[model samples]
Target chain A: MTLLTVENLTLEFDTDEGRITAVNNISFEVNSGEVLGIVGESGSGKSVTAKSVMQLNPSNSVYSSETKILLEVDGESVDVLALRGGKELRTVRGGSVSMIFQEPMASFAPAITIGAQMVEQLLLHKKISKAEAIKISIEMLDKVGISDADKRFKQYAFELSGGMRQRAMIAMALSTNPKLLIADEPTTALDVTIQAQVLDLMKDLVVEFNMGIIFITHDLGVIAQTADRVAVMYLGELVEQGSVRQVLKNPTHPYTQGLINALPKLDDLDAPLTPVPGDIPSPLERPPGCVFHTRCALAEPRCSESIPQMTNHGEGHSAACFVTAEKAEAL
Target chain B: MNKKPIISCRDLSVHFPIGGGLFERKQFVRAVNNVNLSIPQGSFFGLVGESGSGKTTLGRAFLRAVPITHGEINYSDGEKDYDLVDLPKKQLKEFRKRAQLIFQDPYAALSPRMTIRDIIAEPLEVMNLTSSREETDELVREMAHKCRLNLEHLRRFPHAFSGGQRQRISIARSLVSNPRFVVADESVAALDVSIQADVLNLLKSLQSELGSTYLFISHDLSVVAHICDMVAVMYLGQLIEVAPTRELFSAPRHPYTQALLSSIPNLDPDHQSDAQKLKGEIPSPTNPPSGCKFHTRCHYVVEHCKVVEPLLEHPESSHDVACHRWEELMNIKEIPVANLA
Candidate 1:
């Protein structure tokens, strides 16, 4: 069953001066046992789009009327945006969908013990007693490979190392058995060795729990390791998306191609890094038509005159570029 | 690869004191264990390790930013020679002009109040190398031009610039003094991937143009593999491995280095090789393990490895390894973990 489906997710924020379109009109779906990666640099609006599914964006965010976030839990569908501050929203926020951040220290409360925080989260999400919640939390902790978890559970977040803190965060996030886990730069702060361990654990848990994951990051290497499908975002617009094999091996969009080229590969160290031509434009100075025309080498005059919709390249591979899209259709 | 080294260190170590009251026993965190290193002139020497591996502290010790616990660091640029440890006060101030540092976070390293021109010119003023304000401005302009900063934006504050541009401003500041050796501590780690390439290319080109040695300290292997000519792997405050970049990457000797290389997520999905996955966390630097600090996480452990710590020994051509069984384990493909049992 489909875990979540987002349609035409157009979001805007009201600043003091004016409004900025944080997320352009986009649509995607998450199915159980699949990982969808959203890749982009800063100002690319990847995080903003992920936050929209949970309605976790700030108060000033304005969603388009056509925007729809349909979340399904146990064969029952609910509109996530329509859910006001109540039990339904709570169920969706922590019960069905859970979020783990990059920095584990900031997420955990300073004064409370890790065990207490996990217990509170479990009790709030499920209809269980405190003792039952504690039991479940400890089991989750042990499952995340935290040795002597019971003793560590009583300690504060500061006592744990960086890698250990990240594991504890993952444990807390999974205690409720969430249907979808949104991991935003989860391993960006970890060392390579620790990241490998965590990545392996996450892959295993996805299979064991049989849940969907929306992994958001800027690293293509990580996306290749974890994601089944890839969505390449450039300045609030999703330029291309497809299966991991298609998008990475034969990327149709120029921005996605540039990103892959810029990444230094261990196997081939002689190739020089080719940075994308220009800086990501600030939202205030956003371009007129195709957002990436200023930096895109293949952009034409028509690219600056009108917007291009996604042109299909078969097998769910699509790109929103006049040049590449036309080429794909011609081929 | 055989050029005479510009900087050499022997018995280098940096240990910081932990909390200690009157009744409590004094303890220390041995950040950089006694290690020897030689950096060739005009080479991008990469120092790699995880957090608490003391790469940062080692870099600072070279610049004399941090007080060394015990060591002798000799610096020579074919013009002047200065001993970092026993230098006089006047010579130490003079040594500042010969060495400089670049910080990790470009956002914090640059001042928000100062304009781009002033930020770059501040180093010249502090060093008192220039005679007049016009000379400083000219030097700043020249360096900024090389760093690809727009001259018109020189009046703008750091907040007005993007992350890439802010990094450029800091680079211009560091290079304006014409230092012989520069330690860029995770300089491009905080930037976006697209911008990181630009900064790295700039660093590479500028290194060639200025003819200066660089200690590029980073935890990222891929980045170091591309730019560095030589690489050193640090573990638990010790230099476990050091070799030419190609030699180290192609055939790493140390077990820890092998695990580190294998841990990087290969971009090719089909290239996933579970060669050796490290087991536990790095032991605390304070109460380090008795024999070998990495023995706890090493896959191929033995009773001998648990009793005697191995010194850095060169068992092959130009490759240094700190493992006792490297030579014996070289010909064998796999030493079964069951051997430990």
Candidate 2:
């Protein structure tokens, strides 16, 4: 069953100059107990779309008429966009759908103790007393491999190491037992050794909790390791969505192909970086036709004149591009 | 190859006095201790370590950004030689001209108010490298072009650029000085993987074109592996081992180096579990262990390793390792962990 469904989602920002389309019309569904990786470069609207699902977009962001997000909770479906303000968002934000940021320090309060913040969150979401909440928090901390849990519980965020702090944040996020965990570039800040450890822990947590996850990052290698399904976003549009193996092994979209080509593989150190020839056009000056047409190497006159809809190629494999899969492969 | 070493450090250490009051016994936080490195002329040398390893301090010590507390630092370029620890103020200024640094965060390094052209030309103006305004502009344009920055974008401020473009500006500013040596501390760490490759390639090409020596410092071993000709592994400010990049990755001598190399997440999905993950965090640098710093977490650490400090000993071709039981450990069959298949 689909745990969350986003349809015709459109988000705009009110800049000083004019209304800028940040996330153009996009639609996708995440099933229960599946990891979906959103791959894109900067200004690709991947982050904006993820934030929109939680209604965490800034005050200046203007939602278009077609924007709709339905969350299936306890066999009932409700529009997530209909919920307004902190009071209503609390049930969905941290209680049902938790979010972990890229930088652990940014999300964590430096002044407050990790234990204090974790217990406070537990108390707010669950009807638990202070003592019980503290116990669970410590247990969760231990589960994440933070040594001397009780001692660390009293220590402030600044005292813990980078790896420790990230683990603590994960523990705090898991303490609520949220069904949908949104990890945004979570391991990007960590060292390689620590990154491997954290990735291992996250993979284990997903299996134990059987939770659906939205893993957003620019690292294709990392996404390939963890995500079961992958979605490629470009210039505020969902360019492609399919299983990790299918999409990664045989990407259909020209933009997706370019992104995969650009990535440096460890197996082939000699491969020169063939970057998509142009820059990501600023959101204010988005291309008139296809968003990726400006950068697509195989782009034709028709591609520059019209936007292509997502065309299905195989089971759950779809892409938005003028060229066919075989033609794109030939390139 | 006949040119003298660009930078050489012997038993170099950078320590900070912790605990206040004159009467109180001064405890030192040895950020970098007993690190010996000889960076040859025009060589791309990599310094690899995690946090609290003193790689940043060592980089700063080359530029005299941080004070050298102990040992000797000898810098020479065939034409001249100067002791970094004892250089006079006048000579230090000249030394600054010879050695420059590039910071990691492009966002924080460049001033938002200054135009890209002005940002790149600031070093030339401040150091009086160029006499006329036109000369400075020419040099800035040259460096910017070398860094792949569009000439049109040079007129705009840093905020107008992306992370990759801003980093190019930072690179241009660092290279505009025409320094013989450059210390790049995690220059590509903040960038995305693809962008990182682009920047790394730019840096590599710059080194070749300018024929300048680089002290490349980073936490990412894969990057260091691919780029640097020589690799030095540091643990708590001490040089644990130094070897050729391919040799270091293929056959690491020190246990710490071995663990670090194995931990790098490869593109292959199958080989991640086979890595021998290091246990425990780096000990507090303020009150470091008296003996080998890595003994606390080393799986094969013996009693002797905890009691006596091991010096960097040469056992192979230009390869140096600081460990008590390296030979014995090397003899034992390695546990077959998943290789990055």
Candidate 3:
């Protein structure tokens, strides 16, 4: 039931200084009706990985020959990375797989009415008349919980509130009946209450539509609330991958443990925050061995000399850390 | 807890005029409206709110960065007292040395052109706190070390540092002035989670070392819960609730406070509290709703809430709420903590 499988995704960007690896041989899969949360900080390449799924990376991006992004569409497997800008690409971009950004305002055209944009998007993918497209767009808007759909449809993006605009973007993205939805920090720009509302809406939509979502965000709380499975990334590497409960409650990797510990818990107010020591190394100056070895508390001497392979810890929980892998093996 | 307040505001209000034309009537955007609070000496006081909640404006008003439209702000440091609203020109410049601000965005706060050393020492030189260049450099170096920045980093520009490093530099610059009062407006908001904790710990340690009073303004509730001694919740530029941090989190009186607390996404995946989520966006400040500003969004809102503006009622020694039905709300038996558990 795997909707998309991204294997050995080594994406490098050609910078003026040199070619820098942004996502280094990362592998993961998104299954049907599943929420795969990609949790990471600034330089984790979570966004780059998500972008690769839609082939949306900039022209400077260089994917390794071994890199493979396979998408299952209508019982047929298609190589997503091989797609160039055309009707076929459009089908993958907005037809089957849709993307939403942190800033909904940026994705939408300010000059055009939301209704026009939604209708235009529908027309682009679906072989339907303008009238039929308009009907579907309004229905989609109403589906995402935008009140007075007909009125809101006529108004431009600027006329709507932040939450409403996000909803509109979601509605547009969903209007195409996209199989996979890439939500990149969808709720980061929103207020807590608004965020809660949006999260609730997304959860409801996922259940109703049974769509696979690749939720990318830095907020662990949001990930814990929404995601079924989680992937922890650091410095363009997948440091850990497991079910949300397993990863959150019993994280084996020092980096994962550090990230969880760093968060301020409302339930346990007295616990002192222990931040992961040192800053994330810049992409240009990526550490030689395990990228996290520089800051990891449990890092051994050997950790600084070799990259750790992903070791299975019971069920689907896997961590890429030499010490943790050894500990798991011992257990 | 009984220490004298370093800063206190009495019916403070900050307003900016908008759209004043020959034919059109002049109107004011009530940024900070009638906020009354006190920051006790050496206590980390938190101001929590949404974007238009006036928390930033209130902090700015305290630092005299924004013009006060009404009421009075008083600053006292156990020795000297000054009415900040109408201080003399010379005294105002002197007051600058006593109070300082730490901005949210580390990337923008530090001047990219200046070296880390020059940036940290600029405050001291402007205030004329140190007499010689060597004295300034020594003070800068000491502050930098205290902030956990390497002495070698002093020569590099801000562009060379990461977000966390730049934030440390910003903190060093703010603290180098030896200010008694520091207004930190979303100081750690820009930082990553791990780095945020580091900066928060540093701030806590620095506060203890210098015994400086902090008016920590942030939109983040969890962060405020971790750091602040006392918490105040603002809605539409008005203070709706104020209580001790523990009490406020444990048992919030105002419905707005309750909704806000419940809305915070808990880390526990299994524990989804059935707390009522608030509806609608904050009303526009230009044409705010009459009476209670939060009435439109409050779940327990009644007809009385729409027309009658409830004044802040001191129900407990440490707790204050502006809700008319706070007493009745409290009288209800405690909701099961099972969801939270």
Candidate 4:
């Protein structure tokens, strides 16, 4: 079942220089019990799209009038963008959907204990007493693989290690039993060994909770290991979207292909890393037509002339490109 | 194999004194403990470890950035040889010109107040390498072009450039002095994946063009595997394993090295790795475990490992490992992969 649907979401920010579009008209859906990976580089607007789901964009952000963010909660659809600061927005923010960030330390309060923060969040969403909230928080902490939860509960966020702190953050996010979780680069700050442990924990939790997850990261390998379906973003545009296997094994978009080829593969040690030529254009200097044409190797004259619509190649595999989309259609 | 090493160290130990009081007992934090290694001329040697593993400290020790507690570091560029530990002040200035460092954070490394040309040419001015203003500008422009930076952007400040461009400026700044050896400490970690590849390629090409040995320090094993010819693993300020890149990746002897290699998230979803998952966090460096620093988390750890420290031994050519039961553990093959869910 589709838990959330974001349609024609366009966000622009009014900065000191001028008004700049951060997220172009991009759309995707997150279904329950599925992990949707949004992969992009800096300024790719992946984070902007994720924040838009929670209505967490800053005040200067200008959302397109046609933009629609529908959240299905208990079979009732709620338009997220229409919600103001009220009970409905609160319910949607932490009750039905919760978020975990890249820096666990920044999300957590330094002065407050981890258990206190988790208990407070739980009490805010659910009608429960302090005792019941503490009990559930302990259970969530243990579920995320933190040992000695009782003692760790009393300790402040700074007392826990980096990996443990991230786990605590996850536990706190999951304590509300959210239907959708937005994890933005949660494990990027962690070491590789700890990253493996966290990834395994998340996979296990997804099965146990049966909740949908929007995993946002730049690392293709992490997306390949966890995401059921993947979306590739480039300078505020959704360039490609498909199943993990299809997109990674046989990527159609030139931008997606460049991202995959740029990574240093563990299997092929001899292959030279081929980065997409040219740097990513700054957001202020938006390119005409396709945003990625400046760096794309297979860009044609038509690519610079007009924007390409998302052309479907096969079942659920779509790419926005002029050259490869036409070639796929020709086949 | 017979060629002399460009940079060699033996029994290197760098310790910093902590908390001093009139009546309180003095303590020390041994950042780099008895590390022994050699970087072959023109070889890209990699150092891999967690944050507290002292890989950065060891890299700094090569450039004499840190005080050497007790060790011998020999440096030779085939033109000059200097004992790095207690070099004279006059010779130290010359050594500074030959050895330079490329910092990890591009945002912090370059001065935002200065123009890109001034940032790259500052080293030349400080070293007094060039005679006139024209000579410095010519050298800076050449270095900037070599690093693939747009020559027209030299007049712009650092804030005008992006992360990858700033890193290019950082590279140009470090290379402008024409150093013999460069220490790149997590240089590409701050950039995006696509930009990281671009910087890595630039560094590789520059290595061949300049013939400068790089002591590449990073926590990413896959990156080290792709770029470095030889790699070393560090744990709790000690060298656990050192081997050729192919040999280390294919057959890691130390348990920690093995765990680190297996923990890398595989790019293929269908491939399920049965490699042992390391448990617990890296122990606090101030109070590291005795005997083997990694024994606290090693799966195959024995009672003997807790009592006796193991020295790095060359079990075969070009591979050194510091583990007591490596020979016995080598006999047991890795477990076959189970069905993927």
Q: Rate the local accuracy (lDDT) of all candidates.
A: 0.90, 0.86, 0.92, 0.92
Model 3: per-residue Cα lDDT over A1-331, one tens digit each? 9999999999999999999999999999999899999999998999999999888899999999999999999999999988876877996889899999999889899999999999988999999999999999999899989999999999999999999999999999999999999999999999998999999999999989889999999999999999999999998999999999999999989999999999998877888999999998889999988999889888788988988999889899999998988887887
What local lDDT does model 4 show for residue A321? 94
lDDT of each residue in B17-51, candidate 4, tens digit only: 88779987778888999989988989999999988
Q: Evaluate residue B279 in candidate 2 and report its C-alpha lDDT on the 0 to 100 scale.
A: 75
* Candidate 1 CAPRI assessment class: medium
Worst 10 residues of 4 chain A by lDDT: A84-93
Candidate number with the higher TM-score (2 or 3)? 3
Query: Residue-wise lDDT of candidate 3 within B1-341, one digit each (tens)?
Result: 87899999999999999998999999989888888988889999999999888999999999998999999999999878999999888999999999999999999999889999999999999999999999999999999999998888999998999999999999999999899999999999999998999999999999999999999999999999999999999999999999988888888888888888888888889978576788988888877888798999987789999999998888777899999998887787463221222
lDDT of 1 by residue, A84-176 (tens): 986768867888999999999999999999999999989888889998998888899899999999998899999998888999999999999
Off by over 4 Å in 4: B20-26, B335-341
TM-score of each: 0.98, 0.93, 0.98, 0.97
Residues A1-331, candidate 2: write the lDDT tens digits. Answer: 7988999999999989999998888899888888999988878888888888888889999998888998887788878989977888986888889988999988899888998999999999999999999999999999999999999999998999988999999999999998889999899888767887898899999999988899998877788788889999888999999998878888788777777776655444456766566567888898977888887778789887888888888799999887765465565
DockQ numbers for every candidate?
0.53, 0.38, 0.63, 0.50
TM-score rank order = 3, 1, 4, 2
Interface RMSD, every prediction, one decimal place? 7.2, 3.4, 2.5, 5.0
Instruction: Using DockQ, rank the candidates from best to worst.
Output: 3, 1, 4, 2
**Best model per DockQ:** 3
Estimate, for each residue in A1-331, the C-alpha lDDT of model 4 and write its tens digit: 9999999999999999899999999989999999999999999999989999898889999999989999999999999998987677886789999999999989999999998999998989999999999999999999899999999999999899999999999999999999999999999999988998999999999999999999999988899899999999999999999999999999999998898889987667888998888788999999999988988888788888899999898889999998997787788
Ten-residue stretch with the least lDDT total in model 3 chain A? A82-91
